[model samples]
Structure formats: structure tokens, C-alpha cells
Target: MKRFLTTGCAAATAIAMTASASVAARTLDPTKAEDALEISKRVQCGVADGVPAVYHWSGKVYSRVEGEPDRHLFNGEGMNIRQCVKITDPKRGTGYRQVSREVMFYLDPETNEVLRTWENPWTGETVKVMHIANDPVNSRPNYPYSEDGKPHQISTLRRQGKWLFMPFEVPLFYHNVLAGDYQDYVGNKYHAMEIFDFAMLADEMLDTKNPTAYPTVSWVRISDWMPWMKMRGRQGQMVFNAMGAKLKSYDELPKVIKDEIALNHPEYNKPPPGDDPRPNETTWTVFKKMVDKEREAAKNNK
Candidate 1:
């Protein structure tokens, strides 16, 4: 029901102007299914021993609403290494299977390194069995357009060991308020808006309480491979709930709320380990201060 990005012009400007352009150039464009599949054939999806190599990432998650100050629920710079596998012969000799493993290293925001390691203790090998490639949005056989007839792209992409599910890049940036974009296997789009034209944030970093943190607060702007007018841009706040299917607003949330959303509704929070899960206290402290400063600055500007 939600949208997805496909290889197209949407990401051109952001990727071209940034240093990571070289890597970003490889994203796939679903409009040309033949071309996308061609590229996938060229990719080395298998590891040296036939297992997929794991991919790791480091980032943060932030919270920003109208009246209340913004907060950071997660600030650890961690790694997520995933392994992709395809099994043809099962014990029952019937169905197929795919698997992925994520190893995490949560860090202390100040030092920018690992503070602790958290594994998916609940996930038995069954987690890997559920690793089917998420359905591609662009390739969806059902209703794919929004209410406004805006052309939208909705799909998932996985190549080698890398994967990008639908509507993930949104919250990732919201937590850090950074700007940028990336192309996925299908060449769908992912972008971050640089609020107030402030500094740029990296996908691997999260600027916590430091007033000087990346110096910018940005949200995501998504485009389906459809036309510009048809594309829709979502506020970061809503993206989280869409990804997780259910989430309480900052005001609605209890002072102490554990985000089991990931475990309860993985579909809503498709991107496993949605945003950085740093302590809520830090997120609260930093956001309140930023909002206070921004509110004052707004008055002076007026």
C-alpha cells in the first residue's frame, strides 16, 4: 500500500552533487525491468563460501513535533551485517528458504564507537526463513497509485547481501535530521532534506545534543518512478508508523516506552532495527534544547 523508490531521475541531483555519487550511481531503475534484472545477474550475490557477506551501518534516530522539542531515541553508531541465502533442498524436500543475520554494535554517542552489542535473541533460525525478498513496489500487480493518481513506485530490493525495504530511509534521517539520498537494487529513490539549508549529515553518523551537530535538520522526500506531480513527500513523523504500522506520538508515548514495534509489526517497521535505538533520555534532552534554541532564533528572525 505504501510507496517505494525505483531507479530514475529522482535521485540524480542529490547523488551527482555528493561525494558518494560513485556508489550511488549503481541504483536500479524499475521502469526498465529487463535492464534491472540484467544488472542483478551481473552482481555477485553469493559469498566466497556461497554465503552472503553481511552489511553493517552506523546511524541515529530523532523525534520532532510541532509544540514539543525534538528528541533522540537512538544515538548509537552501530553496524548491521546481514547474510542472504537461498536454500533449495529442505529436510521436508519441499519449499525454498532465504536467510539473513544481523549483528549489532550499539555505541555511545559522545565517543562515536560501540558501547554494547545486542543480538536478536528472539530470532531463531526462523528469522532467516522469513527472509524472502520483499515484493517490489514497481512490480506490484495490485493498485499502485495514491488517491491523487500520482504515479508511485513501491518495491523492495536485495542484491548480494545488501537490502533496502520500503519507507526506511525516512526515519533514519529524521532521527539525525540529515540530507542525502541513495539508489537501491531496483533503482528506487531515497532522500533526506537539509532543513534550513544547514550542514549535511552522513548515513553513517547521527548528530546528538551537540548544537554544532551536522548543523542541519532534514526529512525525506520520496518520488515514485512516476511523474513529479504524482510523487508524494512524507513527513518523517508519519513514515515511522507506516513502517511499523503502529507508533505513539511523543506526547502520546509514555515517559518509558520500549519500542517493541519492530518485533510486533515488522511490516510497519520493515527496516529491521528501525532508526537508532539510543537511550530515550538523550533524545529528550537534546530535542528539548534544540527546540528551545530554534524557537528563540525564530523570534529574532521575525
Candidate 2:
């Protein structure tokens, strides 16, 4: 199981001196749970209430190894279609559930074409590329109250002029499905960090006139080399940095992404149904499933 950590103190410390009460002082209340829920809804999905939205982000993936200069591994394009469902809990209060699916495709560094295979410069071996096509990356219903009956506040917030900056730092640490159970004794574990900074207009979030807030987003990721890379427990990591925004429509994605999704993954063009019930998929889990399928096929043929 992977753990996700976020501390309001850390984020507040970083921008406490800069955050000021924007014009939203008269409208949105940063302290209230209902208002905090509104802020999150606007930044993560939309304020349109029950409407689906699409987020398109693109960036380059890199290789970072000890005693070696960083190398650009591939250019990646990603898109996620999501929607928030309003849920009311008499005991827990008002909240929402975010349901969505996302996909990220790795491209050739120079040509920018979707990569099918890659030659690992470090290991000197060719390996098939497995692009990210995770589905049902949904979130639990978020309430204004914590489990202990405390108010759950969005910790990382900044208000500057007309822009509200909300930075979310998510650090992940957990068991690596591909690694041996002996990992408890050894030291192999899956670890990664993802930072998402969303910038939006305070007015759009507060004013009922605006159906949604189209916030610009910056996404940064640090993690171990993807399993598909065949790193074999190599000493290195992967870094991804990209900028994007909540687009007005899903068709607005890059042509390459649009065409790719249309051909093989047309399902990604829309958000999962509001009542979708399925387990979330991760790269490791998907990779394990693929490996298991191949093994079963080989055994059957024998």
C-alpha cells in the first residue's frame, strides 16, 4: 500500500508571507469546509457542478543517474477526463467524489512520435515501451470534517493579485509489486513525488455567474525508472516536468494525443460514468498483469 502525505504547515510556511486576501474575501471563505470544497472543486475539476471536464498536460521525461549528467528520455503527453459528484453525509457534512481516468503517452525525444520501443543507452538493450493508460484513478469522497471530527482544510493556498495558487505536494512510498517479498529485508520499494500547482482566478471560483474555473496547472513528477525500461534495479530515477491547463473541451488536446486516443483508446476521450465502480490502476499493477498474462500464455502453449 502506498501512502500519500501532505502537511498544511509545510505549504503555509512556504507562502504564508505572500498570500493576501484577494477580492474573494467578500465571497469565498478559505476557512469553511463548504468554501474549501468549492476551492478544491474549481482547481481539481470544475465548479460547473455535475459537469465533466478535461485536463491536458504535457512534458518531458528524463533519466537521472549517479555520477552522470541528466539525459532527456522522452517527451510525454497526458490527458485526463474527470467529473465530481456531490455527496452529502448527514454525519460527515457535504463533500464530493472525483471520478476520472487518465492516459500518458511517451514519445520519441527527437521526432515526438509515440514510441513503440526504445534502446536503453545504459543497459544497451532494446525494450518495448508501455505507455500509461491508467483507468479509474478516482478519489474517495472528501468531507469538510476529518475522521476525528476536525475540519479538513486545504493546506497549500496562495492569493496574489488576481491569481490564486494552490500547490499540492504528494509523496508516495510503498511496496513495489514487482520486487520480491524480501524487500522488507533488502531496501527495494516504490517511491515517488508529484507536485501540482494550480493557478486560477478567485472571482471565477466564488461568483456563481462563472460555471467553471479554467485554471492553468504545473505538474512535476519524480520517480524510479518505469518498469518497462527494464532497469533491473538499476541505480537511477525518472523526472517529469510539464505545464498545462483545464481545457474547455476534450477535443482541444494535441493532435497526436487526439489521434492516438481515437484509434486505440477512444474510451479516454470521456470521463468514467459517475457511478463507475472499479479498482484504480497503477503502472506497476498494470505491468504485473501484463507479465502474468504472458506467463500464462506461454505455459498454455507448452
Candidate 3:
């Protein structure tokens, strides 16, 4: 099993210096389990009737090798912007929807440049890709609200005015053609597990004075190497440590990132549609799908 590390002292100090007076004024009773859950919900998921928010995150991915110290793989940065909106349709049950769009960038180790285009060894095809995701499914268990149109029940432990560390495991499957003749090609399935440790500030979420002043959250994830790296049969996992804070405006994004987006993917610079369909696709899934489709089209033409 992978181990999750808590936020470093440096990060904690930074938060302390920048935290609002309202945040610093509140006192936490670690023994209050119910309060912990309520705080966790507010930090992880927005409260009912709350405004939409955006979070910006940047971090490094390391290759964790057995018996050897982790090796630096690449840098990553992304944005997750989401909103909770009312849905009048009764059949939906929840009567509210959380629409979101997530985008990630894998940067070159030395130059920190985004790898937007590359050549595929399997098919020798030039590929242009971006890492963006959207999830339109019902809210998760820990979210502030549930699919049944009810609020989440508080059921976790508390520590220092925040919920005790929680663990989340996500299983992902990737399908592709490893190798085969055009007419004899078959799909190959790969499995990976992603685990995360989540924690956040309870006071910020509970603050009604500033609904838009979202709480800060910190997390770490351990998972397999991104398939886009094309490390075929590689032997290592990636460890990602990142911290997120709610953004008041898109302009708050790092100037470097903003410039990059303007030059490379200007379309994504704008906020996502509120009612757009959920995007459950992954980088590997989409790549394999496209490759298979192209091959099939070629075979049919011949």
C-alpha cells in the first residue's frame, strides 16, 4: 500500500500567514466528529445553493521505484472549475447539478514546456492531445449533497478543526491494441489504481459572510504513470502532491499558464458550459479509441 504524507511545514506556515482573520478566529474541537464531517463536506464539495468555484493546482510527478528514491518524472498543473445549479426536472432526483471541467498539463522536465504534440510509435501517427476531463455523474458520497436530493450525513472524525485524513481509491481501465496484424488486431486492457489523501479547512467552508471565499484544500495521489508518456511496460508508479485554493477570478491564474493557454489552447481559457454532458473519458481511453477507429477505417477502405 502507498503512504500519503501530510502537508509540509512550509506550506502550513504559508497558509497561516495568508489565512483570513475569520478563518484564524474560529476554534476547533477535535473531539466533535459531526463537526468534522460538516467541515469536510464544505471544503471538498460546495454547500447547497453555493456559487460555482474554480481551483488551480500545480505539482510534480515522481516515479517511485522500489529500493530506490523516487525519480522526478515531470511537472503537472491543472484547473478544476465547477458549479452547483438548480435543476427543476424532478426525475433527476437531486434537483441540483454539479457541472465541472478539469484540465491537466504534463510539462517537460527541464524546460517545463507542455507536450502538446508527439509521434506514436505503434502507428507512427502524429498525435495532438490535451488532458481535460468532465464528470457529469451524480455527486460522490462525501459531497455536500447526494443524488437523492438530500445533504450528506456527517460521519467522519475531526482533527484540529478539520476532518481526519480520508482515503479514496479509484480504479481505472485502459483499452488498446498492443500489437497485431491489421486484420487480427484485438483490444488490450490495462488496469491502474489511483489513491488519494484529502484534507481541508472547515472554517472557510462554514463562513457565510463570504460564500465566494472558498475553503482551501490539500491532497496527494499515487497512481500509475500517465499512459500518454508511452512508457510501454514501464516499471514504476507516479506520486503527485498538490495543494488547491479557490480562485476569485480566472485572471488569478499564473501569467505563464495564461500565456500558454492563449497560445496553445485558447478555447479552454473560457469557463465550461453549465449544463454540458459529463466527460468520463481518459487520455488512454480516447487515444486507443481514435487509433482503433483510424485502423478500422483503413481496413474498410482496403
TM-score for each predicted model, relative to the true structure: 0.26, 0.88, 0.62
Model 3 agreement with the true structure over 104-186: per-residue lDDT tens digits: 67776678888777554334756564454433322422333445745444444344645344456667665434433442355
Cand. 3 Cα-lDDT? 0.56
Cα RMSD for candidates in order: 23.9, 12.8, 12.8
The candidate maximizing TM-score is 2
Query: Model 1, residue 296: displacement in angstroms?
Result: 51
Displacement of the residue 62 alpha carbon in candidate 3, Å: 1.4
- Residue 138, model 1, lDDT: 15
- Tens digit per residue, CA lDDT, model 2, 1-302: 12222466666765764354323244768888777877777776755656788999999999999999999999999998998888888877888889999999999989999999999998999999999999889998888886677886888887898888899899998899988888779978889999999888877766644556899899999999899999887898999999999998877889999999998798888888777889898999899999999999999999
* Poorest 10 consecutive residues by lDDT, candidate 2: 17-26
What TM value does model 3 have?
Answer: 0.62
Give the per-residue lDDT digits (tens) of candidate 1, residues 1-302. Answer: 12325444446656666646444444345344333332222121222222332222234544444466654423422111222222222222211122222222233335543333322222221111111122111111112233454333424432222222222242222222211243333333333332111122222112112111111222232221111111133222311111111111122222211132243223422222212223332222333455678889999999
Off by over 4 Å in 1: 1-35, 38-44, 47-49, 72-74, 85-98, 113-302
In candidate 1, how many Å is residue 184 off?
33
Give the clashing pairs for model 2. Answer: none
Off by over 4 Å in 3: 1-51, 66-69, 88-95, 116-151, 157-190, 193-200, 293-302
lDDT at 285, model 1: 37
